[model samples]
Target: MDQVKTSIENGVLTVTVPKVEVKKPDVKPIQITGKPTLSTNFEEVTWAKLKSAICAIFLKQPDSCDLEKLYQAVSDLCIYKMAGNLYQRIEMECEAHISTALQSLVGQSPYLVVFLSLVERCWQDLCDQILMIQGISLYLDRTYVKQTANVRSLWDMGLQLFH
Candidate 1:
């Protein structure tokens, strides 16, 4: 159901990438990839394994990865780490994701559109990969982030990592 249409008029090429169309009162779930569901067995998911998967994904490897599995692994850790009073580890990992993303944006031509696009894309990727795990840290978000008027929400916290 996904498609790309292209038209060439004169010297310019117009490419159209179709986005998901929604119907009234029946919103479809966000489909991040073709293989959308990850097995929720987190017992074997170590930080090293998760880190490797993340590096592969960010490095744009051609291998098809199950992001749902990665997210579930992350959620499992959040339940244990975030509540076990090891917030620093989670913060560090988030920062690393942003840093690697920013590094990838280097060496591109200095176009405003490209700059803004990369920044937004960076944030979007973080949100897409992590926000779905919100329920894992929903209490932390509601208590630690939302309770304070000036603090950013869990979603914003990821965005700020890029900034």
Candidate 2:
């Protein structure tokens, strides 16, 4: 491991932290837990608002949105349209993957296993990608899914879909 260095000048002290690198995950990643650590970026108000919105959206929180504020904050940052495009791209990719799996398999035992594996990959990829951006799983299903009579959590839904 590389060492972090600290230096002192006339009236100032400087500390340097080495950047850590991440390796590609084996096979794929899964949402094994409610939260996984990821690299974090700027915490300015705009980023904070976006992050909060992301958390709320993931959690399916009813009051987590204030569209007017979201518009203002995103427009102020000049990333409103870009963010929308990126979000759509992500959603489209997810939907494409699901549709591909559904169309290619014929629901045989082996094919079912393969499909389950894909679902596993999907769960992992979703967890990892979203965690990379939001840095939290926001586990909307934890409290409600367990207690609700008719609701299925994403994890549950993924399993049922493939099984």
Candidate 3:
């Protein structure tokens, strides 16, 4: 057995201990696995459901939308690193709705009051529909949109599309 030696020199304590052979436990390297395999069709199927729900909501038939399922789909897409695809799809849908809304105003009565009222009504409807969509996709906005640069927040994107 090795003994420890201690000494005090110039008001400083010094301690020396003999060394002993130490065996290190074996550590095996872990095989790093990639993310779970998602079927090539998963994204398309999920986006189809989401797109239908979005269109229904825009048509003022939100009661037909399964909000919980939509939310889960959005979360799943984000978790699977498909947030960019989801974002682009939603943006395209909004653009289509906005274009349709603009086209609806093209041949209305020439009276300024009616035109202004229709524009205001379209704006109001757009804001309401956007709020609903934003609620369903809240997780994606908070997680992916917040972390990714140049990605607009949901509400901002809605407003931009309307503009």
Candidate 4:
């Protein structure tokens, strides 16, 4: 039997209720919104900013830019079906970076050991930069590149730049 008892003593009131399990209502409401579209120039502008971030990564100053925003920009472009063009721009940027990096080793052939060390360092730095870029463009790599035939993954593309 369910029972509730109440008592008052010395101007103080006390109440006691039967022990019962109370279930909470499970009413989860999800907010849904229509798809968002970017401006025609959005891709160009976002790519420009991302290019700067890539530059920062190559410069070994990745802390200069907001990585989260860069990741979002890449994801947004991929979502908007701009992955192909975005990949091309990334390829161009990476190619340019590799060319510029190799140019530093041009005159160091006179010192074989120094040249070799410089090459090793350059390779390692490039690897590190590529890893950072892969992190930012993970969505692009996983979605578009994975689904597209003949398209190399970001890491593979970065390494191919050296070849």
Candidate 5:
């Protein structure tokens, strides 16, 4: 025979049941939005798409950028830019092209934090290239710029020369 007892307290019902332990299956966290959804083999995504996506995310959210947005941006860019050739062997070469473009942009403006953030969002290979370009830019600035010149001094010179 089964026996059961219940009591009501503070507008609630309480009941005692047999103790049982249940194990739940381990589940992987699903990242639905703002994440790169790669193909099964992981070879379908091109580096160009990834880099552009990362850059777009940086442009969109200049202050609060994350890996998920970076990944999504890359995925979306890949789909739009290399739509027809994404599945082709040529996709493998996109990395080189992307790296060169990013390096060129960073070289043009090393002081911009956006460039650095974009590099951080990219793959290690692209990041290395960007860093190398940035280093060269910094070297040039340190070597060529006169350290003794101050903003006030420059203003005074401007007044003398122009005014």
Candidate 6:
């Protein structure tokens, strides 16, 4: 209970404390708030089902069975050989059907979730093949034009505009 005080000649006043007390540290227990939320409506669809559905669509065959069985049946078709307009038509149909199916199952089952991933993969693969073919065609076109340029030049006048 010591008290100290000082006053300045002009305008200052000061006070000091005699002692201070320190308390020991204490630990408090932590509590978790709530359970995690999970969606229980949808069943997990397998990769096999997705594969079959894609195959059926590409092959231009009917899909009568469940998605899993349809995927299995269609999976064996040679999708690579089917290109150009045919490929595009199949792709569009497949995308539409899959999207519709998935939307219809909202809160019903999670089986259609795999469709999104599978379609993306298939589309990417198809695009890659199409690009490769276009690249080859471009290379062949350039080579053919180059090879013909020399022969055509030999026959025409020095100032020939068209071959």
Q: Which ranges in model 4 have alpha carbons more than 4 Å from their true place?
A: 1-35, 62-64
lDDT of 3 at 75: 98
What is the alpha-carbon lDDT of model 3 when measured against the actual structure?
0.91
In the range 20-76, model 5's lDDT, one tens digit per residue, is 678999999986787556565443444444445434432343324444543444344
Q: How close is candidate 4 to the true structure, as a TM-score?
A: 0.78
- Model 6, range 29-108, lDDT digits (tens) per residue? 87878865433421113223433444554444654546444333223221222123222333344455445544554465
Estimated TM-score per prediction?
Answer: 0.44, 0.26, 0.75, 0.78, 0.19, 0.20
Q: Write the per-residue lDDT of candidate 4 for residues 1-163, one digit (tens) a residue.
A: 8899999999899999999998999999987787666787998899998999988888877455588999999999998889999999999999999889999889977888988999999999999999999999999999999999999998999899887
Q: In candidate 1, which residue ranges exceed 4 Å CA deviation? A: 1-84, 139-153
Q: State in Å the error of residue 9, model 3.
A: 73
Q: Candidate 4 at 33: error in angstroms?
A: 9.1
Error of 3 at 144 (Å): 1.0
Q: Model 2, range 1-163, lDDT digits (tens) per residue?
A: 8889999999799999998998986786655766544334422555567656654544445435475665454444332223433333334444454455555544534676777887676566555434433222122334334555775544444444444
- Across 21-134, the per-residue lDDT of candidate 3 in tens digits comes to 999999999887986789989999999899999999888775555799999999999999899989999999989998899899887979999999999999999999899999
Evaluated with TM-score, which candidate comes out highest?
4
TM-score order of candidates, best first? Answer: 4, 3, 1, 2, 6, 5
- The TM-score measured for candidate 3 stands at 0.75
- Count of backbone collisions within predicted model 5: 2
RMSD of 5: 18.5
Cα-based RMSD of the predictions, in order?
21.0, 21.8, 8.2, 5.7, 18.5, 23.2
lDDT score for residue 52 of model 4: 91
lDDT of each: 0.60, 0.49, 0.91, 0.91, 0.42, 0.39
lDDT of 1 by residue, 1-163 (tens): 8789999999899999989887779768886767544346443444556556545544555334465655555555555543333234455666787787788888765998988888788767777655643544455565555445666665676767777
Per-residue lDDT of 1 in model 6: 59
Model 5 segments beyond 4 Å from truth?
Answer: 4-41, 44-46, 54-66, 69-163
